[model samples]
Every structure is written in structure tokens, then in C-alpha cells.
Target: MTKSFRNLIWAVLLVTISCSDAPKGETKTASLPVYKDVPYLQDYSIKYNKQGDKLMLSQVFMDRNEVIQVASSEGILRTHDGQFLYPGVLLQDKTYRPLTDKNITAITIYKDQFVYLDDKAVLSNAWAGSLYLKHDLPKANVFAAGNDFEFLISDGPMLQYVSKNKKNWTGVLDKDKVKAIKFNKKNSTFWILGEKSIASFNPKGQTLKTVFQNGNFTSFALLHNKLILTTLDGYLEVDATTGKQIGEKKTKLPWTEITYVDVIDGHLWFGSTKGAFMLKKDGKFDYYYGKRWLPSNNVIHISKGTDGSILILTDAGLGQIVYEEMTLFDKAQYYEKQVRNRHIRLGFNATLVDMDNGNFDTGRLSDSDNDGLWTTMYLAGEVFRYAVTKSEDALQNCREAMDAMERLFSINPVPGFPSRSFERSGYKERLHDPERWQHSDDPEWDWKSTTSSDEAIGHIFAYGAMAELMDNDLKDRAIVLIDTLMSHIVRNDLYMVDFDGKPTTWGRWNPEYVNARPKMVGDRKINASNIIGMLQTAYHFTGKEKYKEKAFDLMDNHGYLDNLMWPMKDVAKAPDDADDWSKMLSESWNHSDDEMYFIGYWGLYKYAFNDTLKTKFKDAIIDHWEIERPEKEGAWNIMTALTGTQEFDLEEAAWYLREHPMDMVSWNIMNSHRKDVTFLEPNFREQTLSEVLPPDERPVQRHNANMFRLDRNYAKDGSEEFSAGDIWLLPYWMGRYLGVISAPEKNN
Candidate 1:
């Protein structure tokens, strides 16, 4: 036969033959469509109904398409042909029947008295028809649906329902007071709205129970047996079965309305007027507001497909997020992007050290072998150790810089030398600069040596780190340098309790600007409070009694215990005294705030073998405002409860860190352009709640800024930044050390 005739004969034979083998029972499977990102169409919404699916664009345009017919089964949007799509198991006539891709006959669309055809086979349309329900009825809002029903939130206030009957519109909500609505797809239940409360509704009970009664709810969702609510006050996740609230996180942003609520891969996604947030892995909120992801801070709607693609509707436009399995390389790159900044040092190789700013002089006063700055080396070591797996070129450059500094120390007479000035030009150019080759007396003469102590600690840490990196040769050298410095302190009994010989002398950078500030007199005295801590650290690392003795004496006998201001009392100081140079007793110190305290002490207490001191150290953890929920401010107030010896209560701190899931914050604090702004940083605000505000008013500000990364660093040109140590430290002390290291690789 001819080629054309042979092809026709094969086509006819295929058409005539039955596609299925078993006449009694055949399993059918369908593949869901992969969604791509849209340009910028705000409020792009989607909802599946009995007749078909509806897509709304910008809340002004509505498109209708036939996804499922009333006669067919209702299941997930499993697989699709060019013109038709299949869903998951369908519940019909009391029988659960699974549908497959081949079973989909035709896709249709339904609008105002008109049902469109899928002849063109487009999945969604911008606008299909008008709403004839009522002029006062709110515009159509999209909601996730299963089986026989789907929810429709109108622009007006009423939340209605569409059932399996193609043309039916059931007014499940007869009241006009409904403000927010969320469907528990897992429980197959809906949360209706009350005046200032929320009512749980199931088909069995006509009278809904008031689950939330204190304030008005803007938006809410149900996930993992809990009901997450976004209100004008804060974000709250409550027990679905009981009326009790399981987790309630408040924010600074006024959530008068929640545009959308989605529970994706166990995380609660909240879209509000302020921004879009993901309930982070740490049970805190994390904001997604950068350039690559969210187009607008104002989120109006959100939804997800069976393929795990998310459609976010913002004030500016719609964002499509396709969440697939990320490779290890992808995750590593993500973290590197977050922690590394190339703009500030685009032509250089050193990590941008944050010391020497604010009271620390922003690191500009450093004059020592400029390349010897241990803080930058420490940061480089921390970042490169992990980043080496991704980029070897970057790793080698970091290694070379470290080696050069090590050589400088080897050639110099100083025992353990610290880095001073960093060159603005490239490393090659930096090698030739006079600043890089020599040390400066100005840094020490001007009392800028406090950083020297911090840098010393960094050097010590870098030594251990380098030992891990350079195979012990450089590490041994590092240890020798460290020992040399320790010997200097030991010989001098260099406990600097006073700047000059007198207690009232002005020898250092004092926040209160007071002279000498009542130095702690000891056989061994240290001029700097920060230095004492460093001495303790040095002692811990080297097993030197002299350093330990000095540290213990400074800490226990001479009011060094009182030197660290209690965060509660200090942060509570009046706003006018916010920057007061007269406040002698304060909890915070330069660069080393509460976060540093927790990070530094976590290691210190873990090694000290003193249970009592550990308890005190933990008790001192300030539960200030969280970065995520600023409207209801406070940091992880529940972290202590979760890990400390404190009792375990569902509503307490301990339980909250593990279960009090919230979102990340949107703004940066260090770059916030104010010295006192540190008080508002997530770490300060959340961990030190008692000091953040008065006791009587604490409740209102408890959950504000729930999404902040407190210990995070940012770039001068405005970009995201974090620290490897922070990643390792936050999770480690919070009893999530495994979580921190394995976080990127964890299965969703």
C-alpha cells in the first residue's frame, strides 16, 4: 500500500481498538500542568468549581474555563491533553472513583449565564463574564476547592459557595458581617467570619463556634490541625479541632485585610497589604520582598496547583512560583547569595567587616597590618569553608588572603596580630599599599583597641578554622601566635579595669560618656569590658588558668556581672535617653548585642560545665520583638521555653520556638541608618520583650516583626545578607543545630 494509505489504515485501527485492557477495573492516571510565571497582573486568581475553573485577573477581569463537568468525577488536576485535563479521585454518589488522564472528555467554562468551550484549549482566560449575583456582592475571590464544593469571596463581604450542580450558587454565608474566610482542605471544613471573631463551620453544624473572639480577622488558613489567622492585630494559628489558639504571631503591619492564605508543603503563606511572607522553618515569619521574587509588597491573593506551583496576586502584579525539588548545589548557592555581598568589595576579596561603625568607629581606625584584620579573615573562613563546595576560585582567593596575613604575623614581632586597614582596591593592589604592610600607633593611642580584642578572638577562631582548612601547618602557627598573645596578657596581669590609673578617667569609648565608670579593682584588671569576655574565651580555648582566673575575677568579684546591662531595664530606658551617654549601667555593648550574647554564651556555657551559670545565661535570653510580626512585636520569646530548663507549656516560649511558626521580616536593621535602630532589630526586640516595652503593654506588641533575621548583615548597596555562624548558631542553641546544618537538604 502507499505511505499515505498505510498511515490512514493505522490511524483507523488505533481508533477502533479499545485503549484499556481490563473491562472490569482499570487504573487511570493524569499529569498536572506546569505553571509558568506571569508578567505583572495583580490579583490573578484561580478556583475550581463543579462546572469548570475560574481565573480572575487584577480583581477586575474574570475568565472562565471548563475544568470539570458535573457528570464527571472531581479530583486533582492530574493530567491533561491538549484540550482536556484529568483530576484526582472523585467523590460521587457515595462512591470514590479515581479518574485518569484519558477519562477527561472535554473541558468547559462557566460565567454569568454563559459556559465557554475549550476549543482553543487555553487553560485560563483573563475575563469571561460579569457577576449577576448582586451589585453589593464583593468581587470574585479565588479559593482552593475539592470534590463537590468551592468557596467564592466577593468584593462586598459575603462568602458564597458553588456546588457540583453546574449552575448552582449557594449562599452558605447569609450574614453581611463576614470579613475573612479560609477553607481547611484537609479537614474539609470552612472558617466563616463573625463581627470581631471567627466561627468554625462544618456541614453538620449550622451554628458555628466562635474560635476567635477578641479581634477582627483579616485573613486565615487551616494547616496541620491548626487554624492560622491574620488579623488587624497579628497572625494567629489555632487548633482546628478545639477553640484554643495553638500559635499566635502578631506583626507591626496593620493587617486590616489578608489578600490570600495558603498552606504549602506544611508552611502557612500569608499575603497582606504590607507584604508576602512564608512561615519560616524556625516557626517565625520570613518576608519575600526582594527583586527576583515578589514584585510588590502588597499581596492580594494566592493559590497553588496540584503540580506545586504557586500563583501570588500582588498590588502591582501576579507572581508564579514553581516549587520543585532543589539540588544540593541550588541550596548552597541560595545560602551563599544570602550571606555574601560582592558590591561593597567588588574589586576586593576581603569580607566586609562590620566593626568600627557606630561606637566601634566602623573599622576605619584600624592601622595594623591592614590585611591582618581577623574579623574579615574569620568571616572569609566561615563563608569559604561552605562556599568552597560551589566555587573553588573563590575558595583559593580566600585561602591566599589568609596565607598572606599569616605570613605578615610570621614576619612581625607581635605575638598574635590583628588586621587593621582593608584596601579598597583589588587584593593585588592591596599587596602594594603601605597600610597593608605596617601597623599603626594611632589605633592603639586613640583607644580604638577594643576592636583589637574582638579581632583577637576572631584570630583565635580563625586559627582553629584554618587548622581545619590548611592541614595543621598554618593551624600550628595560628596556635603559637595565640599562645604568644596569651602570654602577654598573663605576664602583665593586664586586666584593664581602668583606662588611666584612676577609676573616673576617660580612657575608652563609653556609651554614657562617663569617666572611668567605676572600674572593677582586681589583682588582674582589664580596661575593656569586652576584652574581659575575650580573655574568658581565650582561656577556654587554651586551658590557661591565668586567663581563666582573670576572667572569673572580673566576672564574679568586681561587678563585671553588673557591667552587662539587663536588656529589659536598658531597652526600657526613656526614648530621650535612648542615646544617652550618661547611662552607665546598660545591657548592650558594641556590635556584641543580645544575639552575640546568645551565640557567644551558647558555646561558653556549653563548655563551662556550670549548670547554674548556664541556667542564668539562658534565663538572660531577652525575648524581644520578632522581625516578622512588628504590629505585635517580640522575638522568639518562646526559645528559652523550648530549650531552657523552663517548663513546657503550649503557649510558652519553649513550645513556640518549635511550633510557633511565623514569617520573615521585610526590612533591614543595621543599614537602617540610625545608631539606636539596633533596639528595633529583630534580635533585640523579640528576645528582650520585657525590656522592649512596659509589662502592661507587652501583649499588644508581642508578635510584631515576626519575620526578621536578627543577626543578619546587609550590603551598602541594599541586598540580603546573613552569616554562616548565625545559621550555625541560631539553630544550634535553639536545639535546632541539626536543623541549621541540614536545613537546605530537608525534604519539604
Candidate 2:
């Protein structure tokens, strides 16, 4: 039963294979389809999905479409209701529509036209404008052998020939000297505008005759049987059929030195300014400047494809404009895709100085000083520009609000700029105060004044952003401030702003080590906030390779990077928990020192993605985020700031941002058991504007003494919102780089 059944199956397969008319010979040819000289095939390509038995083609300005079957090795075929008609050719994904489909058979694929067969297997001259419309360039094979005078323009080339009633009218008084030719259908006469003289060719007399002279004619054309000639002087129009003089009109603008003229669709478009011009049928002419439209203004050989698309050779790079309708979405999507790949990501750490609750607000959390809110205001400007280009007018109000913030920046100078002040409050003076606070005079609280680092980082970033999004007037103003700050920093050669208006070499949280002091300069390290800020500002203005080099250099020398190996010894080890020195890295008294060391590591991973440094940065970030000791909770602000990098891969960053409960808040103190401490809670009031504005203009939110805590502690059942600096950075940068936004829900 098995042997006879197998024989029967083999015989059936052979019968089917024989009837299929497969390619000849014992060996089958490669199944991959081949197409030649199709211009629009670059973006559009087709692949045969053998498993599905379908040909997938790239649709023009659309989605994918499957093909029925490919026609031949030399050409392409499309069927209407199953007839094997050579309708056109396929350039991978784009299908070129052919002129006729009645009797198409064996065909030769060409750039502009389909030199194909009728039903009788006869070669025919037929082509369609469909494929040319797709890419604006004519396919290559459209031209037959030996056609002289080819012009290459943006679209393609054109082949020109003169035919007057089937006679090659030639050899009339220096035929080679003729520069222009026109046809008068009314009288069957030809007006030849030459370099030195204008002549009229009469079909009846068959003789060379002269009418107008003086101006050297460069190019001319017959429009409605009138001879429109171009010269250095202007345009001279005459009736070619009657040989009667018409009005001679001089152009207000000088007549461009043109060499060719084409009257298409009621527009007398010609080549000049070494390019082209379109003269309206109503007698007004418009000059299109530049080779973007034409190859040259001279008769310097151009070619037109069989489908009439022009190709011209010019000095500039190839430029193309398809004479077809382009949808709005198509245009926006084109530019959007190009720019999105290069969109730079920037993240800032504002809490370098450890505040009462392991975080620092601009001033006392009780009074609304809005240093933390500035970056979001800057981000709003970016959203405004993006919205305007997209025509989303709802964002216009956001733009106006950002402008108000810029006005504040210009007027409200902190320690860095002495000329301006928002108000005479403890907040403004706190910028130069080293102590967290002091009574009345405040004695320039040194720790609070240390915020000049945070302010420099914040203001510079906002300045660059404002310059990019605003107009020239506003951008110039912002640039003045930016340049001023850069100059000041270069002059001081120090990290933080010097309180008491004197140079002091303090580095990070270390009181004895001056950042610029040569003795301790080796210990100077840039944190995530400073490094990202510098890289961003540098990238926006100079776009120099050196700025990128400096970024990579700092990341490599000071901290662990994406993939680079650093000896573990290079990292200062955590001191023994019981030792007096161990208290330096402890959350109780030394949280600020721990933050200083951790900041540089987090900044590098977020901004730099060079393959060589990625792994090392990742490992270091994971180590910092996943540490499970009790003191690690104090590291939450640093952890949250690094979360903006998204390099930790802990998956808890997103959860931590939203999970800050309403009632239970954590207090930061030198001793956990000490009642005297700073509370860290969330404050939801938009403080960015509040920082630079008067109390009357500030947005108010219900608050309590525990508002600075990460969790809600003031109200029973823990139902208060927290407005900490870290929470804002998480959602803001995440939404920016990932493009996911918690947009207000539509329809209320």
C-alpha cells in the first residue's frame, strides 16, 4: 500500500509542475525579482513573502500592499480582473501606471515610459504619469537609442525635436546660426529668432526672410501662434501667421539671459537668471529664481523623460519638487522623523545641597520661594514651540506664561547677579547665606548660599532653552545673560558662587577643599547636574567636537561610565558603620556628602550613550539604587534624581515617584531620635512662577509644617500633596524623553 501510494503522489506532483510552465531547464533561476533604473524605488521596495505566497510592496505615502504576481525578468505586470496585461512597471514598492493595458505582453522596463506590447505581442509607445508623480523623477529606460539634446532638471530630462508638417525644414541662411524657433499654426510659418537677426520662414515661398533686427534673440516661443521673442532689451511679440507687428513691451525687471522657452498649461515657463520663468497667459510673467526649479538658464543641454518630467544639471546639489499635491500630515511627518532622531535629552539635579529633609527648596518651605519651579517653566517653552508648529493654539497661553518667567529671570538676580532682586525677603538673601537660616541679617547662611551651583545650572539651561524657542529679540536678551554668566564663571574659575562677594575655594560639601585650589583641585568632581548642564549648553551654541570630548572625558575620569572598567579602589569605600569617620557618609549628619559623591555618577549615564562607557555607568547606577541599608532611604532624593536617567533598571523608580503616600512623612535629622529636624513632603503648588513673583501673583496650595516630607504627615489619614523638587524632575524629564505625558484628560 505504501509503495503504490508514493508512486501515485510523485506522478501527481510531476503533472502539476509540468502544467505550471516554470522557468526552463533543470535548474530553477533565483526567485528574487530584479528591477532596473526606476527612480522612485529607493523609499519603496517589494519583497516576496514566500511563506504567505504574496508580494509585499511599499505603498506611496501610505501603508503596505501585497502584489498578485510579478510579470517577467525584463518588465513588471499588473492585472485588472486577471488579464495578463503589461499595465506598467513596479519599482519594488511603487507601481508605475502604464498608458494602455489592452494587449500588454513582453515589455522592456524604462525610467519614464513602458516600451511594452499590445495584445498581439506588438511593441507600443505608451506611458502614464503615475510613477513619475511618486518620486518626481522619470525612470531611466524611457529614452530610445541616440536622441540628442538631453536636459536634466529636478524631475528628469527632456528630449527635444522640431516637427513642422512632417518636413525637416533646414538649410535656410545659416541654419546653424538660428538660436530660437517658433511655430505659427495659423499660417504654417516658422519664426526663427537668432543671435544677430530675427527671420521669418514662409512655408509657401520656402525662403528665408527678415522682419525685425537690432536685439540679439536668445530664446523665443510661439504661444497661440504669436511669436514671443526674448532679448537683452525685453520681450518682442509679433503675429507670426500675418507677419504683422504687435506691441513691444519692456519688462520692469531686466530680461534674464534665457536660452529656452516652454509654454505648458497656459503658463509660458522658460529658462533664465540661468534658470526658468513662468509667464501668465494674461501677459504677466513671474520669475522663479535659482536652480532649485531648473538646471540652467542657458541652452546648456537638458533632457526630458518620455513622460515629460524635466532633469537639469546645475552647480548645486540635486533639488526636486514634484508637481503634485502633498498632504499636510505627510509634510509634518517627514520633518518630524528627521528631527526626532537627534532630539537631545537634558536632566538637571537641583538638590545638591542637603536641606532639612534630605532636600533643598529655594528658601524655607513655609514661604513660597520657587527656585525648584524654574526648569518646568523652561520645559513649558519647549512644549509651546512644538505646539505652535503643530498649530495647537491651546499652548499659546503656556508660551505667554513662560515669557512672564523670562521677565523674572531678567529682573530677579540672586547671589550671582547683584543688580536685580525679586523682593527684600529672607529668600533672596538666603542664596548667599551659608547657614540654612539666620535671624534678620541672616549672616549669609553659607549652606543656603551654596545654591549658587544649583542656580547657575538651572538658569543657564533655561537661558539656552529660551533662546532656542523664542524669537530673535527674546533670544538675544537671553544670550546676553548667558554670555554674562559664562564670562563670570571663567573669571572666577570656581564651582559655587562666592558668598561675602569673595573668592573661596570650597568644593561640593567639603568646607576645607576649594574646587579651584590647585592643592585640592584633583578632588574636584562634576556631578550629574553640572555635567549635563554644561554638555547641553555647549551642544546648543558651538556644536563643537571638543564639548562632546570634554563630556566624555569628565565622565570617564571622575566616575563609572556606561561600559568602561574602573578599578573598584578608585571609588572611596563606605566607612565602617561604628567608626567616627563612618558618620561622614551617614544619613544622620553627612547625607549632603553622600549626595556630592553620587551626583557625578548619575549625570554621565543619562546624557552620554557612547557604547564604550555604557556598561560601567549602568553597573555603578544599579549599585547605588539597589543598596538596601537603612541609611539608603536618606538617599531617596539622589535616587529619584538618577531615576531621570532611567539607567538603574530597578523598575521601582516609576513606582516610587507616584507612591508617596499622603499621611506618613519622613523627617531628616542629625539624630533620627531628635525632635529638632526638617520634614520632607510633597507640595503640589506650581512654584516656578512663585519663585520670581510677589506673593500676590503666586499660586497657593494648602500646606502644613510637614509639607517638605516625601509623605503626607500633617493631616489625619495622610491626605496632603507634596511638592518636593525630586518628584517634579521625575515626571518632567520622563515625559520629555519618552514623549509620554499625563495630559489633562479630554472633555473634563
Candidate 3:
């Protein structure tokens, strides 16, 4: 044959091989569109203090740039350097410049200028304006500004209306004291709030009209010609023109000690002695309390801020709830930064502990009982992120986290046994569960023993993902780790033999121990599911027939298939005749086991030896996801999307990610006192409410905790902050890899 013909044949053969070697199902992973600019609230605080004493913040307003300005008993102080401060004393900075040196008691925004009431006069900060009303009148307790040099002033007993620098109308309540005065632009009148009455004074007509009376009014605001009056017990809405109550008194609020009320941006906001809340369009309130959203809980005033944000002025500081427009992808990027900055310790997903009231600077990354599991989850997320984006940073993250996982096995004395965690040797006294930590061969390091099935399953899931999605060294390392772990389990008769050369508690998956539990017990089901998935992953990656044989033996002879595929509804409390261990295991649904089941599902469905078993695993995963639908867990829902199913509650998963608070500090959030939620009777699943609260509204917890939990006041003062690794990034990157969630759409 001719040399040119031979070259042509070789080129055609190379092309055919390249096409065959390309990734399979690339077209199936095509991404869709998740539009950008999704609005969500991001909160921060601006504190004002004098010599360690929290200043008494009374009123808050915004300038044209949305910079917060406060009217306190200590004059007009703004936020610290026009920036948010943490939970610490804020010394006076340049942004604390008072509009005036005089004792300003009240302030209002009139035509984008500061019109304030001082001890000597009512003055304007406008360059061309003058001090129109002077101290010739009683001390001004409250004031409101109106059209072009118009002002309504009150001093607890009488009201004075000044227009064009002259007193136009004077009004007084017959037996009440004036508390607040506001100008209604719709009718060009001054609505006066009293200690016991509501009245409107028309500056044009020079007439005063009583609107309503007989309630202890603390504050009032005008909205669409209606008046919202705050009382000691609750609040009332009154029609401005007819002087009739709009509806029944709104007493069923989060806090009833209503100190102030305002209608900002068409939303009703309330400031109680406890905190501040906004009435949502659904009639429920988005409660903001504790250090998570405020510097202190004693809110004194609320107002509209720039870009439709809410400015909550508390006795201690200003809590600005800024509604920033961002997509879920943007949130993921934010969490990515959070994890890298404060949550990584020795490449493990760690928590920042011993914080001084949620101060990130005062905390240290601490070891956890589930360090292996968390790191595995974070490693898997980075793998998926790298697969989708081909990001070099993600690849490096995967390398570091895989090194940590690999060291977990090598650090322990027992072959193929992964340690729960490891830290510097001297920290045994300071780390968690000192008894579980032992000195490794390396003098500088210590490894924790008594690892459970949770770590095993997590390691297998991550390794399987890396083996499938990564290249060269990563894939080789993952396959080797999978083989090492599965070989140890198989050789030791399906048990994670510990340093003591015995099966660790909760690491046993042998048929003898598995069949001993009652069928309804969760441990039995979780162990069976995890072992099968691990074995399948090992067989798939390592090409080990022994691993496949062990899997089939368990499923065909030991009822492992039935154990895993049993309907979730049927898994419940153990019967009275069951053993004590079984009863203890089935007392309530274990959320940790749910976490394990879903993590294992990645391997169980993806690496199933046959299409029949793959179909069965899909049914099992969807069944578990359906039972978890009420919780609206982002990780679980997104993981369920792996089954290639259309109805995986994708919207709810997006809501979970969107609603997660930017501040992860474990603050003292209390929702049990809320009146709007529908509480459910105590059930086996420990679901506290009929409907679950949003992620930010409830306590911050891992996906393994019950989402229905309504309170988390145990942290003396937000002493801990959780990492977003397993809780947030895992689901996000998994959704991106699965093509259910798209990248941020370009703004036109």
C-alpha cells in the first residue's frame, strides 16, 4: 500500500478513538436558564455607643445616598464611618458627624434635606434655608416637615403649623397630650398623634379635626391616606378621611409591646421593645431579632432605606436589612468565600468556635465529630464545580480536600479505617472528645478513632464522584481509596474494624448484625443502603469482582435490597416486642440517617451493576425525597434531582438556597413565640410545625438537623458559626452538575 494511504487510515482511526473517548451523555447535561437579579435580604448592623454604653436610638432616616442618619437622645449620630459594625463597641468616627451641635430631639427628610428640631429651633440643613421656628415655643418633642418651608411642630401638649417661616395654624387636644405630628401630602394636612387621640389639622383651612380616640397611642404613620397607630398592646389601622377603624386590632403579632409603626415602601413595619418585624404580603411577619439581624433587640424606630431596604433603629444600634439583587449562583460564590476564609482547617470543613458574640475575628476553626463527612461533602462539591466550570481553583480545592481524606486512612493505625478527624497532637485536651483521639505514628499529629458508618458512606460517595468526573491523578487516587476501604470492609466481614481490632459501634453491616434489628428500625435500612452503595462504587471504580460478588450476596441472600427499598412511610417506631437497641434506634426518625441515605444515593443509583437495580434505587431515592418535601431541604431536593426526574421540587430547593441568611452566626433566634405559624402535634418525625419556616427564619443547622426546629437560644450569645460546605455548596454545585440550575443569566 502507498505511504499516503497508510497516513490517511491512521488519521481516520485516531479520529474514531477520540470520539469514543469523549465524555458520555454531554448533551443530556445541557444547562437551562436561572435568571439573575433575584432579590433577597442581606442584613448588617451600625452600632453607636459611648464609653461602652449603648446609645438610645430613637429615629432613623436616610439621605439621598441611603446613608443612615439617626436621631438619638445624644444628638444626631449616623452609622460608624457609614459602614456596618460587628458586635462590639463602635467608637465615634467621621460618619458620626452630627448635622448640628445642638441637642437635636427629632429629625425628618423634607425635599432631600435634613429638617430637624433642636433645643433652640427647628432648622434645615439646606444650604439656602434658615431656622424658621425658634425656641419661643415649648421644647419640640416631635416634628414633621411639609411642602416648601412648611413644618408641623409638637411639644407633648400643643401643635404648631408653620409655613413660609410663619406660624400659620395652632391646634391643641382638649384633654390629651401631643405625641407625634406627620404631614399627609395627599390632602395637605398635618395628622397629629396624641397620648390618647388622633386628629388632623389642615394648614390651608386652619382647621383641626379629631379622628379617633380612647387608645394609648405611642406612635403613628400615614400610608395611602390611612393612619397606623401603635399602642402598648398592638396597633390599629384607621381610615384618614372617615375616622373609622380599618379592621380589628392587630394583636396577634410576634411581639405585642408595639413601640413604633411605619409604612415604608407599601409594607407595614413594627418596632417593639423586643425587635423589629415587617408584615409580609402573605399576612405573616418576617421577624428580625437577636444579634443575627440587630445589634440589640430593643427597636425604637423603623423606616425606609435606600433601594427599598429597611432601617431598624434599636436602642443599641441601627440594623439595616438591605434587599440586594443577586442570583443563586452569586450566593454560591459568596458561600464559597465563606468556606475558604473561616471554615477550612487542615483541608477539612471545620467550624469557627468560641466566638466573642459571633465575632469571626475572635473565633478559631475547631475540629468536629463529622469532619470526614463534611470534608467529603465539600470535596464532592468542588469536584462537581470543577467538572462544570473547569475551574483551576476548584481543582486545587479538590486536591487539598482529597489529601485530607487520604490522610484520614493513613493517620489511623488500623488499615483502611478512616479517622473521624485529626489535629495537632498537643490539642487533645482542647479538641472535642479527647478520649477518641490517639497519637498517630507522626509525632505532630493525632487521629480520632471510633469512626462510624456516616464517615464511610461520605468517603465512598466523594471518592466515587471524583473517580467518575476527575482526570489522571485525582481519578487514580479516588479509585485506590475506594478499593482500600471496600477491601478492608469485605475482608473484615463487613465491619469497620477499629484500632482495638473490633467492629466500631455503628460501623457494622454484616448480615448477622443487620438482620438483628427490627425491620422498621432506621439503622438497619441505612446500613444496608450504605453498604450496597459503597460496594457498588468500589466495584465500578476498582474493577473488583469480589466487591460485586459481596454486593449481590447481600442483596440476594440477606434481604439488603428489601431493607433499602422498603417504603419510607413504613419505616417508623419499632414494635413493643423489639429489643431495646431496636426500640432506641426507632424512637424517632434520625435526620443524620437521612443525610447518609441521600449521600449514598449518589452511588447507589449511579453505579448500580444493572439497570433493574438502578431503577429500584431511583424509586427509593424519590420516595425518601417525597417524605422530605415538607422540610424543603436544599441538599436533599437537589440530590434527588440525580434521578433524572422532572418533579424534584426544584423551586423549593431554590427557595432554600435563596432564603439562607448571609450571616451564618448561630444567633439566639426565637420563633416559638411567633403567633403566625401553625404548630403540629408531636409526631414520630419530630416535625414541630405543620409548615416549616424558611432557613433564615429558623435556627441555623446542618441538613442533618430537623428543619422544623423553631428556636436556637442555647448559644449564650452566638458563640458559633457554621460553615456552608455541606449545608449549601454541596447542593448548589450538585444542581449545577445535574443541569437543573443554570448559571447566572446575562443582564440585558
Q: TM-score-based ranking, best first? A: 3, 1, 2
Q: Global lDDT of each model?
A: 0.36, 0.33, 0.79
Better of 2 and 3 by lDDT: 3
Q: How many pairs collide in each candidate, listed in order?
A: 98, 61, 0
lDDT per residue (tens digit) for residues 1-748 in model 1: 1111112222211011122321111111211111111111111112221223332123211122222222232322321221101112212222223223222212222331122112111121223322222212323332323234333333335544444433423343444366555556566676775445676655333334566565666666677777667765556767767768764465533232456666766666778665555655544344444222344556766655333445455554444443333322343343344334321231122332343211112322223332233234333334334332334644544455455545434333344333333332233433555322333333321211222333443444444334433443445655565566556544434421222222112222222232234332110112233344445546655677876776566567654544542333344322333433323333322222333332233233333425665455444443221221232211233232223332222122221222121111111232122111224433433343312221111111112122332222334312222132223212222221111111222221
What's the best-to-worst order under lDDT?
A: 3, 1, 2
By TM-score, the better pick of 2 and 3 is: 3
- Candidate 1 to truth, TM: 0.44
Residue-level lDDT for 123 in candidate 3: 81
lDDT of candidate 3 at residue 562, scale 0 to 100: 97
Candidate 2 local lDDT, 293-350, one digit each (tens):
3222333222232322232222321112122222212322332222222111112112
Best by lDDT: 3
The C-alpha TM-scores of every prediction are 0.44, 0.31, 0.92
RMSD of each: 18.5, 30.8, 8.9
Selected candidate, larger TM-score, 1 vs 2: 1
